[model samples]
Target: MTTPNQVFEHHELLYVNSNNQPVYEDAMPGVPGIDVQPLFLDPHNGVWVLKVWFHPGVILPRHFHTGAVHMFTISGHWEYVEYPNDPQTDGCYLYEPGGSIHQFMTPETNTKPTETLMVVHGANINFDDDGNYVGILDASEIMVMLDNLIQERGLEPANYITPPQPDHNTKVRNLK
Candidate 1:
């Protein structure tokens, strides 16, 4: 018989109260009008979950994800440059496979900012017009950068954004 202590000890779970999370302004440096609130990050596994806000009329330059990305629009709307006609409005969901390149923007026509929840498995490789490797937004790297930003700005780090404990372990749950 399984002991009481083992009944619910198989998996590592995390809950994020976005309302309590700190909204970092211009989280992606050089990317204007963009803010981010990290929900969860597994640096060792290159996984990240974040809430991103894009101000109206804001545009994200061309870039590609090194891993699959799942995005769910929480408010407002946005569209890719390649298919501006097809917009992802609030409540919509999107799954972009790794290696797909695209640029997104919140059209000036949008009356409010766009907010989305994104779960990514790897880094975002940003490229220049000449197709040169310009920069990367890896989850692990972002964590370090954000830590520094918080220290430099004299802001407290959000609990959810903190690194995982050394003893933390993950296990799969069987829903039978």
Candidate 2:
């Protein structure tokens, strides 16, 4: 029979109250009117989850995703420059497969900022209007950016969740 002690051993769950977390204004340097609240970050697997707010008239640079991305629109509206007719509004969920490329923008006519919860894997390769490579955004990059922003703005540290380090014998299995 299995011992009681072995059966009772369990991992602790991580919980985050987003309201208690600090939002970084102008989170992306040079990108005004954008705010971000990091929820979770797993640098080892290049995964990050964020609550992002985009003010009206904001236009993100064109980018290509090297991994799939899932986004849920919580408020307001926004659309991809390549698909103006397919605007993502409140309560909308969008799934973009890896290799997808698009430019994000919020209409100037919007009365309020658009908010979305995004779960991203891998990196976003950004490009300028002329298609010139600009930079890459990933979990590791975000960690650095967020850290710097916190220090520069003199804000409290963010309360984002991160996985615990694995032991030497730990092995991650690919379910797929």
Candidate 3:
């Protein structure tokens, strides 16, 4: 409905100053000894970004990824139980392809918690040590859980960003 000369409005950039976001300790149900700070959520594309701090000696459930994941270690150390010799330490970047399965754990010997920033696409299908399916976690689920936890605990609201929804007025411009 616009002429060739018409100028379209540009979408504003979204930002999350993670320092303003509250870290929820043991926020994820059934996952203890970890603190989470959601930085962004894209429910439409099943993507979520988080900054997680894992206390020493904590072991996360084994999980399979439905989509790829990128994790960058910020501090301390952690490793998959299956790969004890390949520890992920400060500044380490790890990428997991879709369908990759692993159990995450922080060694009991660590004096401090391990922190990492993770960008996850799609859901994680979790399983117990016996290989029994436990649960699934995705962007929508995390969004809901964080919201609830913030309200229940009277904590500061998380500073996370979500894309603006497309509607009839949405326009796409091809810029070469």
List model 2 lDDT by residue over 1-176, tens digit each: 98564523457778789988888888999889899999999888889999999999999999999999999999999999999999999999999999999999999999999999999999999999999999999998999999999889898999899876655757575556
Off by over 4 Å in 2: 1-11, 170-176
TM-score for candidate 2: 0.89
Which of the predicted structures, 1 or 2, would earn the higher TM-score when compared with the native? Answer: 2
Lowest lDDT block of 10, candidate 3 = 164-173
RMSD, one per candidate, in order: 5.2, 4.8, 4.4
TM-score of each: 0.83, 0.89, 0.87
Model 1, 87-147: lDDT tens digits are 9998999999999898888998888789999999898888776788888887788888788
> Candidate 3 lDDT, tens digit per residue, 25-100?
9988776889999888998899999999999999989999999999999999999999999999999999999999
lDDT of each: 0.84, 0.93, 0.91
Global lDDT of model 2: 0.93
Best by lDDT: 2
Q: Which pairs of residues collide in model 1?
A: none
Ranking of all predicted structures according to lDDT, beginning with the best and ending with the worst: 2, 3, 1
